[model samples]
Every structure is written in structure tokens, then in C-alpha cells.
Target: MILTVTLNTALDITYRTAALIPHTTHRVTEVVERPGGKGLNVARVLSALGHETVVTGFAGGRTGDVLRELLGAGATARPADGRHGRRGRPRPVDALLPISGSTRRTIAVVDTATGDTTQLNEPGPTVSAAEWTAFLSCYDRLVPGAEAVALCGSLPPGIHVGAYAELIRRARAAGVPVLLDTSGEPLRRGVAARPDLVKPNADELALLTGSRDPLRAAHDTRRRGAHAVIASLGPDGILAATPDGLWRAAPPAPARGNPTGAGDSAVAGILSGLVERLPWPTRLSRAVALSTATVLSPVAGEFDATAYEELLPRIRVTEHPAP
Candidate 1:
């Protein structure tokens, strides 16, 4: 089973309008809501990919209740037919702990005309000391059973900056392969904990290494401590630097649509590959294909199955000279 941790879970609400105009109200065309957070998003993709996945983190108040309900409701929304491979063990299990503060909500307003998204994310609920302790206890139990663990997303208010680092250490001690996807100081500290893998987008990579060069930045991140670094380069695809080798994986063409959960999908791909013991090149191909397919999907935390299957074998994974 794969374990995913989403400390600051959210209710992701999406609004669709014909076009977004400044200082003008527009008619809403559609609305969609889903349980979200980087880790939860990864869990959704992993579960869809037929991996037994478990999700744990913080959930409280009305919003938290709603988040858990949505998460649970969509748990088994997978194909029973042989399509997209065999079904995983009944979707992602919600193991979120309760807290005093209400969970946060994120709004994504999509312009149907331009296909652009304007996101408004609220500051997540502040976690208390007691809540943090409870989370640690929950995490401890889940780690032992996980084939791999993904520690993802931003830290909520009142949590220590080194939270991911601490989690990484615990996962490592259990001999579980761990992947981290976050940014800022939490990411810095988490990387130093030497996770099995780290997935950072282009902007985060540039910020972390102070270099705009993807190859150089990936190398620097590995030096700082990650055993492997898969830097997402958006439409250009992803660059991977691992002990096995370095490779650049990209689809033949750029995918167009909402790119919201592309990175999380990539995380799922890599995690699935890790658990299945696939080679680095094959893993990179899956990551790139899944990420691109997510961009072609209409909403976040989901991907187009047809796009995924069509793009999977076509993704190019070419080795790069060591830096």
C-alpha cells in the first residue's frame, strides 16, 4: 500500500465562466468540488492507477467534514473493467485526524474562452500542538504498512517548519521509500532529510538552487540531500536526476487544458513506478505521461485515461550527461 500525508487538506471548489473580465461580474457556467491538497491529489491519482493508497493528515470543522465526505464518496470511482489496469484496493482510505480549526477551501475560477484559471486559496486552519502530536501518532502506525510514502503540500499555521523533515526521518527509519513534494523552507528541510525522491516544479527548483537551469538545479537539489530529484518543467516536460542516471522525459506535443494537478499526477506516477520496481527511464516516462494527461483533464486531481494511454509509450526519455 502507498501512504500519502496531506497536512493542510482543503475543499477545492472550481467555477467556470465564459470569460473572466476585470471588475465585471460574469455568469457561472459550472461548478466542481473535490477533496484536495498535494498529498490527497497524489492519492487520488495513485488509487486510479490501481495502487492501494491511504491518506492521512488534518481535517476538522465543517469544511473538514465536507472534505472527508468528498474523499470517501469518490474513493471507489474507478473502472471495474480491465481498462486502466486492475482496480486498486478500494480507493484511498481516509485516515485524517480531527482538529479544532476548520479546514481551508481553495477556489479556482476557469475561463472557458481562454482556458485560464485564476486560483484563490485561503490560508489553511492553524493546527494546535495537540493536533500535531496526534498526527504523528497516526503517521507512525501508517508508515510500517506502506510500501512507499509521499509527504506533500504546505504546512498549516502553528506547525513547525521542519514537519516534513521529521516525517521523512520516520518514514526512512521504517525502511519505506518516501517522496516529498513541497516548497520553501519546509522543502529545504525536507530535502535535507534525504527523501527517496523530491518533485519540484520549475519555479520552485529555480528558487531552491538560485539557478534557472533545470539540469544544474536538479543536481544541486540532490547534493543538498534528496536521493533523486524530478524537476517538472511544465510543457517542456520533466528532468530527472537519480543515482541510476539522469533523463529528460517529454511528450511529443504539449498538452493544453487545466494544469492544476499535473504535478501531483506526476508524483503518483513515480510512486506507482517505485512500488512496482520499474526502471528509472520507465518511471520517468510514466511521470511525464501522467502529468501531461492531467493537463488535458477538465479538473484538478484527475486525468484523462485516453490521453494517458496514448501518450505513455510515446513519451521520450533520453539520458543527459552527468553535470
Candidate 2:
């Protein structure tokens, strides 16, 4: 089972407009809302692949209520009784924990003409030390059943920058592998704790390592204490660095659809591969295939089975030359 932790979860609202311009009211051509947060997206993909997944994070407010009512139905708390649920049969655990402040919402305006997205993100609900203490028990209880725990997305206001580092330490103590995914200061701080894996998009990779090339940045990030680093390269695919070697995994060709949540979907593939004890090269190839399938899907966080199956056999995983 894969346990996904989203410290800062939100309801993602996507709008399509003919043209996106600042400070102008434009009629939206379409709109869709989903349980938004990196870990949540990872869990969604895992669930689609028949993996037993449990999701945990800080969710609150009416928006949070909507997410809980929808996404929460799928998560069941780890049993105090101590037994792993069989694969494909997930307990609908309310992995959704409530907080006093409302959860945040992110809006993405997609240009109808070019499919470019302009994102506006809220800072997220401010958390308190007291709330952190409350959730610590939840983390402790869930970590044991977790084969792989993915700590993803940004921290809500008032949550310490080293929050993920603490979680990583706890998971490590319990003999569980952890995957860290976030950005900016939080990511910089979390890397010092030595997560098993960290997946950063190209821009985030460049920012963290100060290298213009993603493959170089991925290798640099691996030196920062992650056992491995996977740099999601959008249409160009993924750049991965493992102890054995570095490789670039790309889909055979562009599938052409919504790119949103592709990186999160890739994270799911990597975690799934980890549980199956697949080779690093297999992990990278599956990640890229899942990411490409996600892009081919109309909905974010969703991958078409047909497309995924088609791409999986064709995803090109090539070794990188030494830097």
C-alpha cells in the first residue's frame, strides 16, 4: 500500500477562456473541479492502477468539506487492529483530517487557443503548532502500513518549512521509504533529511540546483541527499538519477492533452514501481508512460488505460552520458 501525505490540500478549479488577460472579466468556456494537491493526485493515479492507497493531509472549510465528501469516501484509516487490507480492496478510510481554518483553492485559467495556463494560488490556511501536535498521532498510526509514503505539495501558512523533514525522519525510523515533492524553501530544507526519492519539475529542479540543464540538476539534487531524483520534464519527459546511473525517460511521442497533474501522476507510477521492486530504469519508464497518459486524458490526474498501455511499451529510457 502507498500512503500519500498532502500537508496542504485544496480544491482545484480549472477554467477555460478564449484568451486570458490580467484584470479583465472573461466568460469561461468550461470549468472543472477536483481534489487538488500533489499527494492527492498521486493517490488518485495509484487508486486507478488498483493500488490500495490512503491519503492524509490538512483539509478544512466548506471547500474542504466538498473535497472530504468526495475524496474522503475512498480513504479509510489504518486499522488499530493491525492487518494489511488485501490489494484492490481498499477500505474507504476518512484519511481526511479536519482543521480550524479553511483549506485553500487554486485556479488555473487555460487559454483556449494555445492551452497555456495561468495559475493563481492561495497561500493556504494558516496552521498552528497545536494542530500539528494533533496530526502527529495520525502520522504515527499510518506510517506502519505505508510501504511508501509520499509527502507532497506546499506547506500551509504557519507550518514549519522543515515539516516534511520531520515526517521523513519518522517514516525512516519506521523502515518506510519516503518520497518528497514540493518547491522553493520547503524543498531545499526537506532535502537535508535524505528522502528516498524527490520529484521536481524542470523549473523547480533548475531553481534548486542552479543548473539550466534538468539532467545535470537531477544529478546535483541526488547529491543533496535524496537517494534518487526524478526531474519531470513535461513533454520532453522525465530525467532520473539513481545510484546506479542517470537516465532520460520520454514517451515515444506527444499524446497531446491536458498536462496538468502529469508530474503527480508520474509520482504515482514511481511509487507503484517501488512497491513492486522494479528496477530504476523500469520505474523511470513507467513514470514517463503514466505522465504521458495523463496528458492524453481530458481530466487532470487521470490516465487513459489504453493510452498508458500503448505508451508503456514504447517509452524510451536511455542512459545519460557522464557530466
Candidate 3:
């Protein structure tokens, strides 16, 4: 089973309207709520891919309770009538630990007319030192049984910047491959822990390495201790630098829709491939296809299975000599 850690879990609410105008009151057309956070998003995608995934993180208060209920309701996998070459069903399980601080809420306002999304995020509740220790204990128990673990998203208040680093070290000690996905100092420190893989977007790469060149930035991240670095280049696709080799995976065409959760879907793809023992090129191909499919999805944190299946074989993964 795949284990995912989302330290700052959120109740994601999406508000849809015909259009968004500045300084104008608008009537909402629809509201959709889901359990979210980077890791949860990854777990959702993994479940859709027919993987059994366990999610652990912080959840408390009314919002947290609602989040847990939504997650417990379970995800419905795409019908497997031999359409995607797989017949397995989705099984996503939640194993969140309680905390004193209430979980956060993220709001995304989607303008249907222009297909644009505006997001407003809240800084999550402050975690006490005791809560952190409790989470670590829980994580240790979960790690041993996991085929792979993903340490994802922002570090909530009261949590140390080196939190991901510590988790990475523990996962590594347990011989579980860990994927680190975050930004800023947490990612910087996490890389030093030498995770099995790290996924950063172009901006995060530049912020961490001070280089705009993706290949250079990826190499720098690898040198900093990540076994592999995959930098998302938006519509350009993903650039991966790994011990096996360097490769660029791109979609047949740029997909246009809500871009939220695309990176998490890519993380799901990579972890799915890693657990399945797929080669680097094929893994990247899956990441690219999944990410593109996420962009085509109307809702965040979900993907269009048809788009993913159609784009999977068409994704171009070209190898390049390691720089």
C-alpha cells in the first residue's frame, strides 16, 4: 500500500460562477467540497489508478470532522470495463491523527466563462509540539507497511521547517522510498535528507536553486542529496534528472482547464510507477499524461480518466545525456 502524509490537511471548497468581476458581487452557481491538501490530492489520483492508498496527517475541529467524513465516503474509481487496460477498483483509506488546532480551508473560485481559477488559502491551525511528536509516532508505525511514502505540501504553523527532512530520514531508515514535494525552505531541507525523489515546479526549482534553467536546477537539487529530481515545466511537460538518466516527458498538446492539483497527479503517477517498478522513461510518461489529464479536469484534485488513458501512449519521453 502507498502511504501519503499531508501535515496541513484542508477542506477544499470550489465556487463556480459565470464570471468573476473586480469589485462586483456575483451569485455563485455551484459549490463543491472535497478533502484536500497536496498529499490527499496525490492519494485521490493514486486511488483512481487502482492503487490502495492510506492517508495520514492532521485533522481536528468541525472542518476536520467534515474532511474526514468526505474522505471516508471513499472515492469512486473510473469504471474498468477494459477501457484503461486495468480492472482493479479504487480503495482510498484515511488514517488522520487528531490535533488541537482545526484544519484549514482553501477556496477556489472558478469562472466558467473564461475557465480561470482564483484561489484563496488560509494558513492552517497552529500545531503544538505535542501534536508534532504524536504525528511522528503515528508516521513511524505506518512507514513500515508502506511500499512508498509521499511527504507533501506546506508545513503548518508550529511545525519546524525541517519536518520533511526528519520524515525523509525516517522513511529512508525504514527502507521505504519517499517522495518529497513542497516548496521553500522545507523542500530545501528535505532535499538534504536525500529523498528517493523530489518533485518541484519550475518556480520552486528556481526559488531553491536560483537557476531558471530546469536541467541545471534539477542537477543542483540532485547534488544537494535528492536521488532524483523532476521539475514540472507547465505545458512544456516535466524534466527529470535521475541516476538512471535524464529525460523530458511532454504531452501531445497543451491541455487547457483548471491547473490546480496537476502537480499532485504527477506525484501520484511517479509513485505509482515507482511501486510498480516501471522504468524511468515510462514513469515520467505516466506523470506527464496524468498531469495533462488533471489540467483537462473541470474540478481540482481529480483527473479525466479518458484523457489520461488517451494521452498515456502519446506522451513523448526523450532521453538526454546527464549534464
Candidate 4:
């Protein structure tokens, strides 16, 4: 099973309207709420792809209750006994730990007419020192059973900037491959731990490596400590720099829709491929295809299955020598 960690979990709420205009009152057409945070988003995509995924992190208060409810009645610590039952089918499970502070909410206002998304994100709840200790204990137990782990999203207040780095170390010690998807200082520190893979969007890559060029930034990031770097280039697709070689994967045509969670989908694809032992080119193709399919969906953390199936054969992955 793939284990995903969202240190700062969120209650994702999306508001859809006919048109989005500032300084004016507008009527909302639709509202959708789901359990979110980057790792949860990756878990959702992995689950949709028919993988058994376990999600762990901080959750508390009313929002946390609702998020767990959405995950099903069994989203708790007890079910995470680190044992996969010999059942008929495998499904996604939530093992989020409780905290004192209430979970945060992230709102996305989608303009249906123009397909524009404006997001307002809360900073998330503060985690205490005790809570962090408890989470690490739980994570250690989970890591041994996991085939791979994804250390994702931002660090909440009271948590150390090197949280992901520590988690990566634990996963490595357990002999489980780890993929890190985060930004800024957390990513910088985490990369120093030499994760199996790091997925950073173009902007995040630029911020970390001080290079506008994705290829150059990816290589630089690898040199910093990451075993491999997969830089998301938005519509241009993904540029991956791995020990095996360098490659670029792009969709046959640009997809249009909500871009939020697209990178998470790509992370899911890559992790899924890793656990399945797929080749680098095939893995890159799957990541690009999944990301494109996610862009075609209006909702975050979901992708159009039809689009994914159709685009899988069309994604182009080209290998190049490392610079």
C-alpha cells in the first residue's frame, strides 16, 4: 500500500459561479466540499487508480470531523493496524491523527464562464510538540508496511521546517521508497535528506534552485540531494531528471479546466508507477496523462477517467542525455 502524509490537512470547499467579478455581489451556482490537503489529494487520485492508499496526518474540530465522515465511517487510528485484510477488494483508508487546533479550510471560486479559479487558502491549524511526537510514532509503524510513502504538503505552525526530511529518513530506514511533494523551506530541507523522488512545479523549482529553466533547475535540485526530480511545466507537461536519464513528457493537446491538484495527480501517477515497477518513460507518460486528465475535470482531486484512458496513448515521452 502507498502511504501519504498531509501534515496540514484541510476541508476543501469549491464555489462555482456564472461569472467572478470583484467589488460586486454574485450568485453562487454550486458548492462542493471534500477532504483535502496535498497528500489527501494524492491519495484520492491513487485510490481512483485502483491502488490501496492510506492517508495520515493531523485533523481536529468540526472540519476534521466532516473530512473523516467523507472518507467513510472507518477513518480512524484503530483501522490503521498496519494490516491489509485478505478482503475482496482494496480501498483507500484514512488514519489521520487528532490535534487540539481545528483543521483549516481552503476555498476555490471557479468562474464557469471563463474557467478561472481563484483560491483562498487558510494557513491551517497549529500542531503542538506533543502532537508531532505522536504523529511520528504512528508514521514509524505505518512506514514498515508501506511499499512507498509520499511526504506531501505544507508544514503547519509549531512543526519543524525539517519535518519532511525526518519523515524521509524514517521511510528510508524502513527500506520503503519515498516521494516528496512540497514547496519552499520544507522542500529545501527535505531534499537534503535525499528522497527517492521530488516533484516540484515550475514556480517551486525556480524558488528552490534560482533558475527559470526547468531542465537546469531539475538537475540542480537532484544535485542538492534528491535522487530524481520531476518538474511540472504546466501545459508543457513534465520534465524529469533521473539517474537512469533525462526525459520530457507532454500531452498531445493542452487540457483546460481547474489546475488545482493536478500536480498531486501527477505525484500519484509517479508513485503508482514506482510501486508497480514500471519503466521511467512509461512512468513519465502516466504522470503526464494523469495530470492532463485532472485538468479536464472541474473538481480538485479528481480526474476524468475517460480522458485519462484516451490521453495515455497520446502522451509523448522523449529521453535526452543529462547535462
The best candidate by TM-score is 3
Ranking by TM-score: 3, 1, 4, 2
Candidate 3 error regions (>4 Å): 75-88
Which runs of model 4 end up more than 4 angstroms from their true locations? Answer: 73-89
TM-score (all chains, Cα) for each model: 0.94, 0.89, 0.95, 0.93
lDDT tens readout by residue for model 1, 133-246: 999999999999999999989999999999999999999999999999999999999999999999999899988899998898999999999999999999999999999899
Query: What lDDT tens digits, residue by residue, belong to model 2 across residues 167-268?
Result: 999999999999999999889888888999999998898889999888778878888888889888889988888877888888888768888789898999
Lowest-sum lDDT 10-residue window in model 4: 76-85
Candidate lDDT values, in order: 0.90, 0.84, 0.91, 0.88
Superposed by TM-score, candidate 2 places the C-alpha of residue 273 at a distance from the truth, in angstroms, of 0.3
User: For model 2, what is the error of residue 159's alpha carbon versus the real structure, in angstroms, after optimal superposition?
Assistant: 0.5
- Kindly state the number of residue pairs that clash in model 3: 0
Q: Per-residue lDDT of 99-125 in model 3, one digit per residue for the tens? A: 888999998898878868888998899
Which residue pairs collide in model 2, if any? 75-92, 75-93, 76-92, 76-93
- How many clashes (backbone N, Cα, C below 3 Å) per candidate? 0, 4, 0, 0
lDDT of 4 by residue, 197-258 (tens): 99999999999999999988998999999999999999999999999999999999888777
Residue pairs clashing, model 4: none
RMSD of 2: 5.7
Candidate 4, lDDT over the whole model: 0.88
